[model samples]
Target: MWIKASGRAAMLGLKKKILEQLRGAVEQAQREGALPPGSLPDVEVERPQNPGHGDLATSLPLRAARAFRVSPMAIAEAIASRLPALEELEPVTVAPPGFINFTLRTRWLQEQVHHILSQGEAYGDLELGAGQRVLVEFVSVNPTGPVHVGHVRGAVLGSTLARVLEAAGYRVTREYYVNDSGSQMEVFYRSVWIRYQQVLGRDVEMPPGGYMGTYVVDLAREIHGERGDHFLRLDETEAIREIGEVALERMVQAIREDLGLIGVDFHVWFRERDLYQDSAYQKAMSMIRNGGYVAEREGARWFVSTALGEDKDNVLVRSSGAPTYFASDIAYHYDKFLTRRFERAINIWGADHQGHVSRVKAAVVALGVDPRLLDVIIVQMVTLKRGGEVVRASKRTGELVTLRELVEEVGRDACRYFFSARSADAQMEFDLDLAKRESQENPVYYIQYAHARIAGILRNAREKGLQSEEGDVSLLNTGEEMDLIRKLVLLPELVETVSATLEPHHLAYYALEVATAFHWFYDHCRVIGEDPADQDLVRARLKLVEACRIVLARTLHLMGMTAPQRM
Candidate 1:
């Protein structure tokens, strides 16, 4: 059920209108002593899951029955009797036992076409976020190699979520956490050094457990091309660290370019080394220690997570006096919430980090920050297939189909649409053949075709001297026209829901649904009628068609995909 805040009353949709009416009715009942004068149950209005029930349903009666010492049906009758008559609602009634149901007026639904046209590209923008500051961190790949297709899910999900949040009125900051300090980074650097030596006419084997990627050799060749044998005169320590930094920069640059191909840009690139170099790591440990959650155990500093009901305590620093990556992560979040003062922070991690989620949440709680403010979205795996055959990847050996390759194979628009068309928690299959198809079987094609079809209609209408903005939208009373308007009116609600749930997959579903509704209306109705008698209808329907185009374009833009005017 949807709850309406007072400030958002003017923007309430049909469902929220019902919620407001129910709230007014409850207040009236309480004033007249029909119910107790105390805290009332929350007013929530929702679309009925089962279509036959009603357009909107409320469980206010069931919630209030126990509190008011009355049967559920009696409470519902009392509330229903006091409901004010409104033109926006039709056939307000009570269902069996407790639920209150209401259907929206068809005229109101048709009028929304004009509303959508008036708003244009801003039709679906919601005020749910109310400008709260939020930071979303994702695709913080190890930077040991090129960004692979394996990181695509979190990258797409996080970037789409950021866009949706911004649409919902949040001040969003997209961030990439650079893992520049750790054992993995050390191995990568040493591997690059060995590759550099091999390119210098020296037969050197790569160190055990170092990077075996072919890209490593490429990096070495690139360095040798720039600085021919100059590094050979330097000491081993200085050469390893300096050469590794150069290689790391190249890898990170490659990652950024690949992400740019898919329209992902970060507002901040936070380095992990900054945590220790800037004393932030010590401050975080100090805060946890003052919160009484830190203790020395087994020659190591532990977080004492067992006190929070965990079965085991996790070490923050090892016995050798080196801090773990977990410690750096705690410092990172501390910087996000306490230093930068972001109201909320979201981290999109791979499924392999599921165990780390609870540990991080515990750290947040122990650091005196509310754990609820931090959200960790775990993105599952993605399997790429071409003609039903699996495409395998191995980032360790650099034998991987990079994200750039995926974008190039299917085009940027198709790649973003397909990657974002599923939930992050759900494992997805990217089928290359279907994505390349230009028919209705491809969803991206189907949606883009609808937009293009509407564009063609509007173009023909203009050539016939019909002005879209000059049409009287009130003439859009046909069932198909009403259906398209209803679908257009749902974009705001979808934006609000996705923003609140931190789920952007709903946008993909809503885009397809909008495309389907527009196609249905276009199939049944003609916007350009040759007969002089139907000119008014043609003009009015052209305006409606233009509104559909606005919504479709806005939807695609939100998902970082293109809306083709001609296909």
Candidate 2:
């Protein structure tokens, strides 16, 4: 019952137990008058950097020393003496200058191998979110072209973050904010119209700053094949309008297909046009205007962002009476916060949108929402690599690399893994040759191979009529066995950490560590021993292997990658 309750507490079971003990000890010490107590600071626990120190450590005594007017070592002694016994932890230690260290019992770590097997796929599931609703909007490239390589990072990051949040017990909505209105859409419409004319053998020049990708030509050809010059007879205005609607639909579909190639999907495709419907845009503007953040200067509507500590004012609507992209963004967030009423809205934007973060948060504040509820993550650009050279353009299209092409080359698993291998703020280099490699040099292969190896071992045990369910896990006392169990138990903790920080890259690194640990255990230990006398050891090791498999599979799934059963 305690294990089940602890599993729901996000599997920081030992760490949490230590924290509880420490807090209780502090209270006991204060009541005993061994330590002067005003209100104690919040007790925090962390894993020590060096394994020799302990499994988990806390500097609560040091943090509370000044407030209590006592030396940290004195406080540590007082608390450590008062700490109640826990079966999962060995004797607690107090280090110099006041640090309380806890080492997990070896038998307790061994028992977790069985516990993890009981959890199976749900081993890492946590109650950290407690069912909070979160909306993660990402990879909202304009519906004017196919998704490019530059957009893949945020797509993978946002999708994986949504998954992690779900594992942490949060109800999450994945959305794509389609920029299907305003000047960009007008340009897109004009560009598609010119391309359609070219497809129809008409002599029409493309407007300045028009799309030049070969996909546009392909779109034009498809439209010609479908419509057969019917739009050619319409007046130029009507033709552009009709063709633009068709083009936008096709482009949005193309964008969906391209993103789907890398396993990115959205629950909602929120069009910018929707913001203007039912005077939603006007209502959003009115909220900001009433907050006294809107200003009229030189025939333009400006958001007085300087009033909210912004370095300069921003245009909400131009002198020409057209709203700026910033205005639509404000309306969009108003929908997310006020209309939809998400507890939190996380926007994953490209590096180019970094400067817009503060303004949007400022606008949220003016709209009577807490600025902290809006989190804007700026994902840096990605550079594709082959061998040692930078990959700039698609060889077939002679344009920037498309997300579809990247997926085709490296595959969906590698695309997700490599895109999420780095923090969102760091530019990543995706190596084509390495991603395709079948050897351990590739982390994707290495991690999957660990799962595959466990699968193979299980298959072998079944052929030999072995039953791991009856295994005595107490026999698993090897250093490598305990070490691997340590990694297996970290998944719930990882989910909680990533959910709080909104960073999914740590999952990649943790998967690799689990793989490395499994590899080491496999190298040093034999699962199915040849001698009949070693059957107990064989069964215990089989249980360990099975636990490792569940952990590896769960980790891979969270990263949006496949956990192959066979290499």
lDDT of each: 0.85, 0.89
Segments of candidate 1 deviating more than 4 angstroms: 1-14, 26-42, 49-54, 62-77
What is candidate 2's lDDT per residue for 42-153, written digit by digit as tens? 8899988888888888999899999999999999999999998888889989998799888888877887887788888888898788899999999999997888888889
Structure candidate 2, residue pairs in collision: none
TM-scores, all models, native as reference: 0.93, 0.96
Stretches > 4 Å off in candidate 2: 7-10, 67-70, 393-398
Lowest-sum lDDT 10-residue window in model 1: 1-10
Write model 1 residue lDDT over 112-222, tens digit each, in one string. Answer: 676777777877777778889999999999999888888988898899999989988999999999999888898999999999999987998888888898888999999
Candidate 2 lDDT for residue 120: 83
| Count of clashing residue pairs in every prediction | 0, 0
- CA shift at 415, candidate 1, in angstroms? 2.2
Prediction RMSDs, each to the true structure: 2.9, 2.0
In Å, residue 246's CA in model 1 sits off its true spot by: 0.7
